[model samples]
Target chain A: MQKWADNRAWFLILPVFLVVAFSAIIPLMTVVNYSVQDILGPGMSVFVGSEWYKEVLHNPRLHDALFRQLTFSFCVLAIEIPLGVGVALTLPRKKGVWASTCLVLLALPLLIPWNVVGTIWVMFSRPDIGLAGVTLNEIFHFPYNYTADPLHSWLTVLVMDVWHWTPLIVLLGYAGLQAIPEAYYQAAKIDGASRFAVFRYIQLPKMRGVLLIALLLRFMDSFMIYTEPFVLTGGGPGNSTTFLSQFLTRLAVGQFDVGPAAAFSLIYFLIVLLFCFVFYTTIVNLGKGEAQ
Target chain B: MRMKKRTVALLCYLIFLLLPIYWLVNMSFKTTDEILSVFNLLPENFTWANYAMIFTDPSWYTGYINSMKYVALNTIISLTVALPAAYGFSRYNFLGDKHMFFWLLTNKMAPPAVFLLPFFNFYQTVGLFDTSIAVALAHCLFNVPLAVWILEGFMSGVPKEIDETAFIDGYSFPRFFTTIFIPLIRAGIGVTAFFCFMFSWVELLLARTLTAVNAKPIAATMTRTVSASGMDWGGLAAAGVLTMIPGAIVIWFVRNYMAKGFALGRV
Candidate 1:
């Protein structure tokens, strides 16, 4: 794609600039203002600079939720990525109706509303009524109650997330797989490459761009997961499933602690930025150090 | 042996995928009383009372209408703003192109939780609270960047010669874009619209925050379940099932573009 050096192209970007500015900048400035002020009430606020930030930084609950959030994100990335790549590999490779059938079926869960995903899981995992709960209790003879046991609650959230979102990775991975031309595979076959060898050398390398997209998207989405977990666990049987977003929501909405919430949010933003920076740098290093 | 193993893996995955969905359907069929009273694989007494309640009750069904209104508005606004920005970004090297692009992506990266409070206050002050336009504009914080990225990718794929030739033929910029450029990237537009629709439709937090009653989203409406009767479990399940329909239909319509789009501009 050739790009002309035209400073006047700035004119074309004006609408997007105005819209995003109105939506993002004002609210962000509001957050920053609240972060440094003690909003006593409507039209009454004290300038309490850095007070909220310090308190939020030291809060034990924040630490707990941060740990839980990180663990959940790590688990999601670990499970979804490889599984998505593998599922993409396994999808019956062809075109037309059969292929689209597979794609649509896999994508169904991804398209459903997050709240509905939560609600469906809630209905499906009810101890006395749910198929899962019933099977675990009756057939498997394992006592499973998401609302009572912390472990059960955590596992249920993880399982629900995997159920709802793994298909997104799969679809992305499948697209990446589809983009690989036939010539490469044919060449691999001619060289007597085994299935694993061909995948390792050809498919993995070719899928890097889409895989990176999948990784970054999955990281951000999973990190900020709110509606599903909020609906499913209500942030817990005991705050076990309460991630950073849930904690932030609790601070801002439930407690109305605007200053702390805002400061906490800034930290949350920084942490996300930090993780993205790390991921980007590592990927860059990998690109520089190795051909693949 | 290889064939057997492959078939087994695929079947296992499919079963894992569909089981919870099947359970939700099973729940939708049963009455709330039956669901609580019995532990059964299939609904012993099937009922459409839940669905009937939704259709009969305007308050319940209006949530769907309100949601569609805002989502449609958001998608249209997102595409309109993103179109020219995408063209500009794709075709021209501006003074701060990289910085501008980064800023857009950063907004997309910003969590909605951070914006909920400020948005609530801002919308209230602006008198846009509980209106479809407010929520639609709020959604642009994220959707605009995504729309631009998707459209830019597609636009870059189109040859620059088309733009040059159209200009040489004495066509104005707006005319060439509307008639020629847009049609060429129609798939990109469809894909972008589908995404904008999905994200807006599914997001409850910001939508819930921005609206109280008149513009309430279906997802938010579903959560307002503590009525005179306890939880209304059957009704909730039925509503959840209904909510899945629109998204399913949209994906089915755009399944082809989705396959192409996912590899490119998709998150």
Candidate 2:
């Protein structure tokens, strides 16, 4: 794992730098530019200088979207992490036909196009024709309509997300579980360790690295979720499922409120960056601790 | 008892995962009228009309071609750039290397929605709008970083001695990388390419925003089915089923490596 001290390696990274910067930096600069100016026309713009920031900071809509986004991400991480690990535990360890089949099926949802996932769920959960919807309404005698009911819409989006993405967690958890040495289990058995004790001591500790990656990946992706919910609920049942990304798109692309939307974009970027910083540092420290 | 419980749990979760997909396939076979009126578990009157429509229609089939174009471009660009960058990170500790690696990763966290306005304007200014390349470049914002991360994991798995030995055998850097280093990590490259293709293929917001009439992705094209004439449930279901085909095929080839690849090879 020892690496040579070679600054010339920067040359090797130059291509990636150019590509990512072309995609990320120039647009970011434009967002920053738009945030400061109020455009009257194509070239006729005034330097508004923090007016948009002030308005966006106090905006109630932004507040609501941020709150909703937080709750959604929290629920995603809470449900997915444990469920993924639990399902992963049930997977067959020895490689064979069943194990391979289980893996392929588990990975199918993760590969589906995001909007298709939304569309599939729309058909699968519709009250009129959807299996879940009809079962709830006719079979179980419960009122379930994602289109007309706010609570139903929210639940639909949440469950849809769980179905679409929980496989990622399961895959990561299964990989982590696979990496644990057989000696650890043998040692646990020799020590007369209970199943709970073995899992707590051996499996959990060993899986920390991958579980952390899963946590951060799930958190960031769920925080930025737009496509599925946008397709499914269209940010409705009267804005119940509208999250931060959809809100920003509405302001910027839908309404052309460039100044406020640009400021809001900056704020949104910073919030994600803040969380990334926390997770990044933790991962780095974990590596360092392991090295020592 | 424990084996029975485990099998039951796995079966339940797998069933939960497959049911929606089954619904999509089932609906694809029924007529739109049948989808609305009948609540049958299976297609009452199975037909190939929906699949036929997709294959016969220019608008429907071109979307798939366009999607494939951009996804291919994005995967090639991502892997080409990420290869050396990943090698650099895996092999050397340069100035700002750690910081640069983390910085590259931060791009993966930037929400695509935030980039919509700026990208729309920026691409239009450069006249790259409505092109598959535009979508490909925009997707690089996320895909490149991920490729670098995953490829780094795989590259680091190869020992430093290989590089040194290759050099001692009178090989130039490029020759060594392509002939010696590449074939050694070809599996890693395949996995990285799969991740790149998967991420770029599944994305909608940027792909939809970047293209218009000429190079529209199938995912974007599928949106047109929701016209005022009510939904084309059968056709839409067929298109949805089609979108999953490429992923399913690619995942099958890489089935053994799925977990390790998802872990970015770190595990």
Candidate 3:
């Protein structure tokens, strides 16, 4: 290992640090300042200690939204992780036309804008005019009205998320899968290990690092889901789809209640940070354990 | 026998994945009346009116151009800053490096909803409100971290021996970076740029918050249509289809590098 003692490298990083700070940190400080006080208008705020935090914490709307957000995140991870791994396992390993087709198909959903995913589905499930809804009612008679029915709305949103994001998990899982050594599989075959045993012992452990990354990324994104459901349901049929992000948006933008909204956002930030720290530390510890 | 079952299951998964996209294309061809009346697999009365409306209207088509301008600008800005920062992190052991790396990532975790109000004020104060630059700069907050993280991983994979030899042969740092380092990580850069473009292109909240009328994204425009009229289903579908085209083109170009970049960043 070699060290470059000169301090010139710091200058190389200065521009990035400054850009990110200007774009991210300064505005965050402003949010913090707003969170602690009541803002009547621009620069017209008076100090109030923790009053907003108390209001945000005690609000039943936040409580319900938090529960819904957690359930949605957990459900997305549960579905996407396993489905992604399964898809990765089935994909052809060698470079060819088939491999290229699969890659293109998988990447398609990831590129579309979030609101468009919702719009597509909203049009897609229209009972009178949409394809899915009309097909279901006509063929299977399933009575799928996602906008009016809460359970149907939740299911539709979940399906839309899975459609849009599962490809990302598959892409990550495939990368991890491709990196496994041929020797490990060859040795497992020589030992007459069953496919299940081979996957459980060799492939699963090898994919642990990438899987953790996939999990954290999916969790964070799903937890902060806003545009998709906002477009799909408008948090309608009595707030069934109003997740935490929507709740925060309703406060900050819709109602313009700056104080509690800012406080609620900080708490939201802390929860996401708490989850990331836990997962990151766990992965780091696993790496250390493997090294030892 | 087991292999046959696995093949069937995989085929089923593929169909599940592609069905909705197939449906969108199917609906885009049908007239509003035909769509309302039929529950058939194929369009009964095919028409191009939806697409025609999208292409002909300046208001509709302009949103796509505006979105592309900001997304492209943001991608270029993010990559340029991130490449050097990624190199510095990968190649050098600078002071406060760990802290700086973590700081970069923290920006990504903060929800945009939290910063919406403050950002509006910040942009207004700085006289950047309603400009494409406001959205582009705000996008950098998340995209830069992503680009840096992915690029660093790719740079780390390239052998340090190459750098040592290049420097020993009297190649300047800039010369080595351009001639040797960049070519090796071209695939990595492509993948990073793709993700940046994808995220920035889809992002609506900050784009909506920062810009009101002049630089409104296509996503924001879709929301506005609902209020303007009683949900112009045909126009919205046309706009939705148009939105998918840029992403489709992007994926086609970078399809091969997708898995590798993802694996490296492990994101």
Residue-pair clashes per candidate? 0, 0, 0
Question: For residues B68-93, could you state the per-residue lDDT of candidate 1 as single tens digits?
Answer: 99999999999999999999998999
**lDDT (tens digit, per residue) of candidate 2 on A54-91:** 99999998899999999999998899889998898899
Cα lDDT of model 3 by residue, B1-267, tens digit? 876776676678788777877777877787767666666678777888989988898888888888988999999999989999998888888778877887788777778777788889999999999988889999999899888988988887777899999999999999998999999989899989998998899999899888888888888888888657735666777787789888889888888888877765543
Indicate which candidate wins on TM-score.
Answer: 2
lDDT of each: 0.87, 0.93, 0.85
- How big a share of the true inter-chain contacts is recovered in candidate 2? 0.88
**Highest lDDT among the candidates is held by which one?**
2
Candidate 1 deviant stretches above 4 angstroms: A277-292, B1-4, B226-230
iRMS values for every prediction = 1.6, 0.7, 1.8
Write down the lDDT that model 3 would get.
0.85
> Considering only N, C-alpha and C atoms within 3 Å, which residue pairs clash in candidate 1?
none
Chain A vs. native, model 1, TM-score: 0.95
For each candidate, report its DockQ versus the true two-chain complex: 0.71, 0.90, 0.67
lDDT of 2 by residue, B97-170 (tens): 98999889989999999999999999999999999999999999999999999999999899999999988989
User: Per-residue lDDT tens digits of candidate 1, residues A137-168?
Assistant: 88898989999998899989999988888888
Greater DockQ among 1 and 3 belongs to 1
Interface RMSD of 3: 1.8
For residues A102-221, write the lDDT of model 3, one tens digit per residue: 888888888788888888888788777777888888889888898789999998999999989888888888888788888998999999999999889987887888888788788889
